[model samples]
Structures are given as C-alpha cells and as structure tokens.
Target: MDIADLTPAERRVWEAFPLGEGVDFREGADDDPAAGASWGPERTVRAEVLRALLLGGPVRDDGIAGLKLWGARITGRLDLKYGTVEHSIRLRSCHFEGAPDLYGARIVALVLNDSVLPGLTAGNLRSEGVVRITCCRIRGPVRLAGAKISSGFFANGARLGSPDETPEEPVLQLNHAEVSTDVWAVGLTVHGQVRMNGATVGGQVNIENAVLSAPGGTALHAETLVVGTDLNARGIHARGRVNLSGARIPRHLSLTRSRLSNPDELALRISSCVIGELWLQEAARIEGTVNFRRAQVDLLHVPPEVWPEHVRIDGLSYRVLAPHRSAEQRLPLLERETEGYLPYSYEQLTAAYRTLGDDAAARTVQLAKLRRHRRTLPRYARLWGYVQDAAVGYGFRPMRAGGWLLLLLCTGTLAFALHHPPALKPSEAPGFNPLFYTLDLLLPIIDFGQESAFAPHGWYQWLSYLLIATGWVLATTIAAGITRSLNRQ
Candidate 1:
C-alpha cells in the first residue's frame, strides 16, 4: 500500500530511498532509459541507487502492468515480508544491497532474469507465480523456507557466493514449493538447494544438485533439489568436484557417478533427463571420462523396454559376472540394467557358463529354472546332451589314453607272432602265409577284451585289459541308443 502503513524500520527505508540520486526506475514491460541516464552520465546505479530502492516503501501500483526495481541500493533493511502483488513481476536487471526480507511475498507472474542481489546480512526471501531468475547473483545465504507458485519457475545461470557479510544457513534454501508446471535451474551456482525444496512442485524439476563443496551434488544429506518428474541436467559445474555418490534416480537416466569440476570442461556432468523406459540403447555413448561402477535398471517382463541387446551390452560392457545362481535363474538379464533392462533368463546364463567351460554348473542353472520357466528357456537346451555325455566322460582326455591303448595292442600282437613256435610259423604252411587268418582270429580276442590273456604279463593284466574293453563296448552301446532315441524324436 503506502509508506504510512509500513513498520518503523520499513518507513525509514522508504524515506531514504528517493534521496538516493541514482534511482534506476525500471518498468516491467520496458527497459529503464532513466536507469541508463542516472549515474553521472556513466549509466549505472551506484551504491546510492541500491540504497534508495531498499528504503522505498512496498513497490506500489505505479500504473504499469508490471514493475522492475532495476539496480536499487538497499542501504537499510527493507521488509515486504507479508506483501502481496496481483500482477506479473520482473527483476531482470537489479541487485540487492541490504537485509531485505520477502518472507511471504506473493505475485502472479514473476521473472528474475539476469539479476544480482547481495545483502548486508541474511537472505530470507519468497516468491510465487511464473518466476524466472536466470543469470543472477545472491551473495548471501538465501532462505525461501516455504513458498508456493502456480506456473513454470526457472533460475538458471545464477551464482551463490557468500556476501561481504555471510548468513549462517546455506547460500540458497528452497525447501518446498507448489508449482503447477515445470521448475528448472539448469546452470545455477547455488551454495545448494536446501532452500528450493521448501516448495511442493507438481511438474518436472531440473536442479542438478549443482555444487561440490560443503553443499550440493548428490552427496550425503545435503543434496540439491528433490525433483518431481524427469529430473535432468547436463554441463553442470561443481566447485571442489562433483559427486552423485548415492543419489538414486527414480525414473530412468543417470550419469555414471563422477567428478565434475567445470561446466566448460571435461569435469561437467551431462544429464539426459528422460529416465523412464530404463533403456538408452546401444549407440549411446556417455562421451565423458565417467566410470560406471555398480548401477542397475528396473525392467518389466512384458512391454519389453529394450531387452536382449541392452541387457547383454550392459552386462558384458560392465563385466557383470554371474551373480548368485539363484538370481541368475530368476532374472537372466540383470546384468543389462546399467544400459537398459533386458529379459536375461537362464538361457543367457547358460551361454555365459558354456563359455567359461562350466557346463555342469550351467546345466544346473538351467535345470533349476527349467522347473518353473521352461517356456522362457531356449529350445535346444545343450545341457541335456552335456549331462548324458560329460558326466560319463568324467576325466576322459581321449587323445592320450586312447592312443596308448592302440599302441599297446599293436606291440603285443607283434611280440606274440615272434614268440610262436615252428608249427606256428607261416613259412612252413602249404600255399598259405596265414597272415590274414592270424588277424581274423586275433581280432575276436581283442573284441572280447581278452588281449591281455595273450599279454607278455599275467592274469591280472589280462583282467585289466578285459575291463577296459568292456567299458568301451558299454559306452558305445549307450551312445548309439541315445542317438537313436534322439533321432526318433
């Protein structure tokens, strides 16, 4: 209303305001040419100008649809703590130079684009409506403890540095808000977002947990803005380096946690706000020096949100080894969540295990899952064949032991021929060398596993040879029977 209605401290601020020569009277809908002409022809609001605006009574309805305080010198404490504005607001070019409290200030549409405000002490403020505060400065710790807004609100490219006199709380606190639409602060240099959380927003939020020092970043308790939907940011610069250490993404996208020292350099943490769908696809390269440690995605079995490919890539890319077999049997694609969710099943685990030469374990994994999810498993479960063959073969390194058996047989036969007596000599036979008959007769004994009976050794060695031959015959018969059964199927 009028300076007469204000408190004593507010009245003193009003009385001193007009006397400050450099009053940069700016209009909400127009740039202040008077603001340009006031500073001794140099076009600037000196400290005196800021002091004047600080003392001016609650900005009255000066006939304009909106008003701009420009660069007003807030020399004294200005309290508009319970004031209310009905129209839109703009603070595009202004600075704060006092302990101004707007604790309950409410406006319809407010914008604080490209502004800077520093105070003598505390920074307790509030705003409502479509607020925009891009490229501004707040040198003192700010507290907008509980505020409400109706539309989109933005404060990008803002900085938060401790003023000449510092406030004990965080540099910026937005504890809660109630916004009807989007709330964004893309490249804000906040001491943190403790102040921002005060408002309960109903739309998407874009505060990237912006800083790295004593506040900000996804560190312990002091995180940036807790967003409503699609929380996103990219090219975010942090102070002592950034950390997304334990921040959980409720939707989809998340940068592999990393250090971001600068927005203009490699240290910037890039974000792709769309965390839904849980999958980013194959050609997606994060294009930074970020290292993804252990992160996973949430996936559903149906309406498949990018499966097989995404799952395998994430699993193989990040070297997701087999987790507990129980987990593997449950959801095969767990390894792929980092990149996206995939329907990893026991079949995939089988493929992985086969590569590791763990056929038995792989078979076991498949068998366990097969009981419940046989339909989901691959058709040709190789484990069936492996169980029939591998277990029986035990330590069967065929080449060495199989070759030794053939050599022993041939050498034994030659010895037997040499040891034969004169009647057994083929040269004395009439018209028959008997070489063919000797082989024909000897082949049966070998088949019967009786080759050791003719062995240069004794009965025990003969029994061993017979046993070896019998095992072979039994194994061959079993293999043939299996082949026949499979063929029938």
Candidate 2:
C-alpha cells in the first residue's frame, strides 16, 4: 500500500492534502516518531479532496490511520450523501467552513473534538464506532434523526445553539436514534430543546452538570426512551420541563441536586414509566409539578423535607418509600403531599410498608386512608364513621374502645347519683345505691336485678333505654375490632 500505487485522482488529492512535518505514509509504516507522526499539524484541506480521500483513498492499510487534522480548516460542505466512509475521521481543533452534511452516510467512526461548525445535518447516519464531539461549539442546530451508532455518543462540554432560538426547534435532536453504549453529554450546554424522544440507549445517558434552557417549553424531551442502565442527570439546570414519560430504565433515574424551573406547568412528567430506582434527593428543586402517575419503581429515594410540594403520585407504585430512613420518619413525608388524598396513593404506600414487613405501619396507613374516605361520604354515613372512629379507629386502634367504655360508666354513675329514680318493685336492702342501678342500665347483656327493679319516670326512662342501646353498639364494635386484630395476627 504505497502512495505510488494510489489512483491518479486519489494521488492528486493526497498530494494537495497537507500532512505535517512529521507524518509519512510509505509502505510498512511503524509506530516510530522518528519515521513519522501519527497525527498531522495545522493545515487547510479542500473539502472535495478530503471527501475523496475519505470515500476512496489508498493509504498504508486503506484507512485513515495516521491522519489527524489539527487546526485544519475544511473548505466547502463535506457532503457524504449515501456514501460509505470506511476510515475513522479524527479531526481535532478543526474549523468547518460550512456544515458537514453526512446525510444517509455510513462511516466507521467520527471524532470532531474541539471543533467549530456552523451546523450539522447528519440525518439517517450509520456509524460503527463512537461519535465523539467533545468540547465543540456549534452555532446552529445538530440534526441526527434516525441515526445508529454502534458505540457511545460522547459530546461532553459541547455548546449547541440554534440560529432562531425558537422553543419549538431543538438545538440537538437525536430522535429515534439507537446507541449501543452511553450518550455522554456531561457539562454540555444547549440554548434550545435537546430532544431525544423514542431513542434507545444500551447504556446510561449521562447529562450531569449540563445547562439546558428552553424557557416555557421542553428543555430535554426524552419521552419513550429506553435506557438499559441509569439516566444520570444530577446537577443539571433546566429552565423548562424535563419529560421522561413512557420511558423504561431498568437501573435508576437520578436527578440529584438538579434545578428544574417551569413554574407554570409540569417541570417533570415521569408518568407511565417503569424504573428500578428513582432518586430525587439532595435538594433537587423542581418548581412545578412532578407527575408520577402510573409509574412503577422498585425504590424511591427522596428527602422528605425537601420533596417538591407539587407532585401527582396517583397510581405510582414503589416497593420501598425511603429504604435509608426509618418508617416513622418516612410516613410524614408521604402525608405532606399537597396532591390531596388519593386512595390508591395510600394503598400503594401501605403495600410498600407491608413489603418491608411492618404490618403495624401498613395498618396505620390503611386507617388514615379510611378516615380520608370517610370525609368524602354523605352526612349520614359520616356520622357512622365518627362512631366507628371513636370506638376503634376502623379496627386499627382497638384501645380507644376501652377509653369510651370508661367514659360511659363515669357519666352513667354521675347521672344516677344526682337524680335517684324510684324502684318499681320493693327492695329488700336497707340502703339502695345508685351505682349498681346505673351499671345495670348501662350493660346490655348483664343484669344485676337492679334494672328491672328500678323504674324511671318520663325522661329518665328514655335516658335509661338510650344508655342501654349506646352500650350495646359500643360493645359490638369493641368485640368486632378485637376479633379483627386477632384474625390479622
């Protein structure tokens, strides 16, 4: 593979393409700095010649092996429409005169580190290796719709912006793209929306420390994305909504210390997602509602005190609420939700506590939920709810029945002592005490012969019957509550 063996067209393009002072492409080239350098120095290359070499070039191994164009400005639009580039295009600190159109092109790999581009239109691109564009600055939008990258898409520290700054237009669009590895955009900044809707990533999507601003619109629209690993966006500052609805991430979706501010609408919509772990702790400030409706996760870790007040947790099921915190501490956090009582919310929480093997805590949540349900009932039913609550707390607090019984006994004894009712039958005892008479009237099943002997007149007779009925209701409630508790045990 000598330069003399190149075709006339290829030989002319290769001669015009500038290689630095220390690069050589003779036959049997080795990794010796004295023989030649792996990367070239700063120089400009005609876009057509560079394209010719990339499309059909004869090198030592028929690949761009020792070609590293540093500070090289490529002139004209490097269009590779439907062409297959077989070499790794590694350009560092290069400047493009126009946007390189790789539309419908298949390439081995692409690395444009520390470069400046007007814009990129690489729609329907197919790459076998990484697409590394680290620390680059693009003045216009980057369109990669329907692209397929076998390895990662690394764009760390890149700054992207659109010409119109429109909220509807995305600065970096990767819609329906498939990446075999991660999409690393750590510390990246974008002026408009970064849309990755319907994309599939085999590894994590790390956007940590990124600044994304699309005010009054979606900053990061990743709806229906399927990430095999975690989607770590910790320390992100987003001015608009960060939507991940219908996404499925098997590992975790963390937003720790992220600041999302879309005060008018939903700042984050994670509804209908299936995630393994969801982390929104460490003072993650979300100004608007974070809807988690119908989302299922194995664990949800959030600081209770710092949780956003505007959250919709309906049908959001989690096996554990805060595994790192105590049950008593986590219960108040769920109770502080501003989204009012949804019965399923409490039910999910009860199931989570039950999974933790804390049935008492689960029952407490169920009791609280029952009280919430009672509040929504009709007035007649509400009165019955009050009776049930006072007696046994919907069978969760059986000790309350003993407190009611003591209160009844004290009141009955005081009433009988104040006004003594005459006995219908003659008493053989010399001193007739009212305490025994009141006990007989209060207890429904037990009789000491005093209730039959004592006859109250007018209102007193009515009061005695009322007391007996009240005692019977309370006794039945207490017995039922005790039976339920025993059965649960």
Candidate 3:
C-alpha cells in the first residue's frame, strides 16, 4: 500500500507514525508520536478505513516507514461487534476517548500495551491469540464476560479503577471467561472488585503482589472458579473479602504473605473447594474468619496459631495438616481450634495423625473427643460417663482403674482394722482379726467365712456393703478396659 492510495484519515495516521520514533512517550511530551495523530478533522475514523484494517488489507509501505500508530487518540467508539478481525492490532501508548465495543467479535490478536483507555466492552470476544494490555491505565470497568482467549490475558502492572470510585462495582469482570493459558495480572492495582467467579483457566492465575481494595465488600470474588494449575495470589493486600468458595484447583492455591481484611464477615471463605495443596502460611494476616467448611485438599500448610481465632474448619478434609511440623506440635494446634466435641474435626485430626504413624497421638485425640462428648450427655448418662472416665479414661487408660482399686483397698483395710466386728455365732474364745476380713469384704467373688459367718453392725454394716459394691464396680471396669485394649491392639 502506497501513501497516495491511503484515505485522508489513514494518511494522517500514516504521516504521524514515524514523526517521533525514538522519543519516550511516557513523559507525556508534546512531541510524542501520537500527540499529533488524531482520527481526522471530525475526530472519527471512517467506517471504510476501519473495515479495511480489520480485514488485514495493506495500509502502509513495507519498509522502515511501516505504520505504527503510537499515542494516537481514537476519539469515537470503535464498534466492531460481531466482526471478524484477522490481523494483529498493536496500538501502543494510545488514548481512547470512548470505550471500544467488541461484543461477539473474533480477533486474531490484540496488543494495547501502555495505552490509556476509558474501558473495554468485549463480552464473548474470541481471540485466536493473546490479549496484552500491559502497563495500561483503565479508568472505567472492563467487562470481559464469557471471553475465550486461545493464549492468555496479560494485564501486568495495570491500574484498573471504576469511573465513580465505587467499591462495590467490578473493575475487571471475567465471569465465565475461559483462557487457554494463564491470566497474568501480577503487580496490578484495582480500586474495585476483581470479579472472576466461575471462570476457567487452563494454567495458573497469577496475581502476585497485587493491591486490591474494595472496602466493605468482596475484593476478589472467584467462587466456583476452575484452575488447571495453581492460583497464586501471594503478597496481595486486599481490604475486603477474598472469597474462593467452591473453587476447584488441581494444583495449589497459594496466598502466602497476603493480608486480607474483612472484619465483620469472612475474610477468606474457601468452603467446598477441591485443591491439591493450600498455603496460607508465612505471615499471612487475615482479620476475619477463614472458613474451610467441607473443603478437601491434599495438604494444608498453615500455621494454626498464626491464623485468626475464628477459623471455621468443620468438615474440612485434608490428608496432611502442617506436614512440616511434628505430630506432637501439630496435635496441640489442632486441639486449640476445636470447639467442644466436633466429631468430624476430631476424626480428621485423628486420620492425619494416623497417616503420620503416630498412633498414640491419634488415640489421645479420640480420648479427648470422647470426654467432650460425655459432657453433652443426659444427667444419668453423664454421671456414668464421668465414672468411666475417672476409672479407666473411657477404656483408653487402664492404669487409672488400677489406681482406683489401690485407693479402695487402702481405705477398706484402714476402716476394718480400726473397728473389730462381732461374730454371728458365739465362739469359745473371742476372735477379732480384721486383715483377712477386710480382704473378704473387698473381693466380691472371694469369701473367707468372715462375711457369711460374722456380720457387722450399724455403720460398719453400711461400710461393708459399700466396700462390696466398690469392689464389683472396680473389677468390672478393669476387665472392660483390658478387653478393649487387647481388641484395639
């Protein structure tokens, strides 16, 4: 295409392409390449020129004078709805007075690097290649709902802010969008919500070092999102909730050193998510509750004490909890989070300890769970449970029963020796030996003719019956504990 063949508007753009080639455009200098470039006297591109460019037709000479519209101001709406654009559009450091309407358009590739745009309305856009918007400043909301990008979406170092600075409004909405590769938004800053709920990513969604602030609402709402690899948001500082509930990540969900603050509600709600590994460690400060109810993960690498005191981990399943720590250290952390007798929590902790081959720790958790459950029983049943716990630790500690038996024997022997009892039948010589008699009364199944031949009177009779009942109860408890221990082994 020769310069003589270009239209008046295209000719202006062609002339301004090489005017300031080597000048830095970031300083907002007046002599910049795009400073003199405009749509035309009418401040609008003709439909014919846009159609020709979108159709991949020749626009400039094939040499060092090739067309490169840098810092040009597209004054009017560039509506390409439902159109098929075959060529790669590279517009750098340009400005758009109005948002481009690309709804349902099929483009090859789009590179708007370092451009200042009002916003983008690209719903259902099908890009065969990458969509690059690196270092751009978007002053309004970018609606990319249901977009399908073959490569990825790169918006690194970009600043996305709402037009009215509304905290509830979404600055970058990617709901249900599907990307073949990663969604790279590293070091990005968003003044409103970055809503990516139900989006699907073939690779990782890297939002490392991003600053997201949407106070009193969700800053990052990616609920039900499906990521093929990791979803890393490390070093993020979010003022509102980071909700990732029901998300499915095959690899890991890393939020290391991130600070999330939503004091009244949940700061991180990861309920029902299926992740390979979850890392909320290394100085991650969350001001609100981090709920993990019903979530399943292979490993959870969080320092339990560092987390907020209001974590909700009921029904959360993980194969390993703090695998880097020993069982003795982890057990206390697990116990500290449990609220009363949460059976599922105890079961999960017990399974984790068992997986580490720490059977003693596992049993200890089970015993604590049982004791807590006993506290919730009815009056009579609770009394019985207390007796079982005190005697044998509910069949988990047999030595406790042995100690009870020793105490009973000492008490019964002292009582019997202090007061001698009369014989049932009068003997020729008075017999008042008490050691063998105490044993006879204490052992329920043994009788040395003291209980049958002679009987105690008044208080002594009541004491003897008490000794008999104590003997039977202690013997039965010891037998039960021994049986349970052997069976468990």
- lDDT of all predictions: 0.42, 0.78, 0.76
lDDT of 3 at 10: 61
With a 3 Å backbone cut-off (N, CA, C), the pairs that clash in candidate 3 are: none
For candidate 2, lDDT tens digit of each residue in 110-151?
888878887888888999999988988887889898999999
* Residue runs of model 3 more than 4 Å from their true location after superposition: 1-52, 59-69, 162-164, 323-341, 420-468, 471-489
Top candidate when judged by lDDT against the true structure:
2
| Model 3 / residue 83 / CA error / Å | 1.9
**Candidate 1 worst ten-residue window by lDDT:** 266-275
Residue 462 lDDT, candidate 1, scale 0-100? 59
Q: What is the lDDT of candidate 1?
A: 0.42
TM-scores of the models, in the order given: 0.47, 0.83, 0.79
Give every collision pair in model 2. Answer: none
Clashes of each: 36, 0, 0
Error of 3 at 232 (Å): 1.3
Off by over 4 Å in 2: 1-42, 61-66, 162-164, 323-341, 357-364, 378-395, 423-433, 443-449, 484-489
Which candidate would rank higher by TM-score, 1 or 3?
Answer: 3
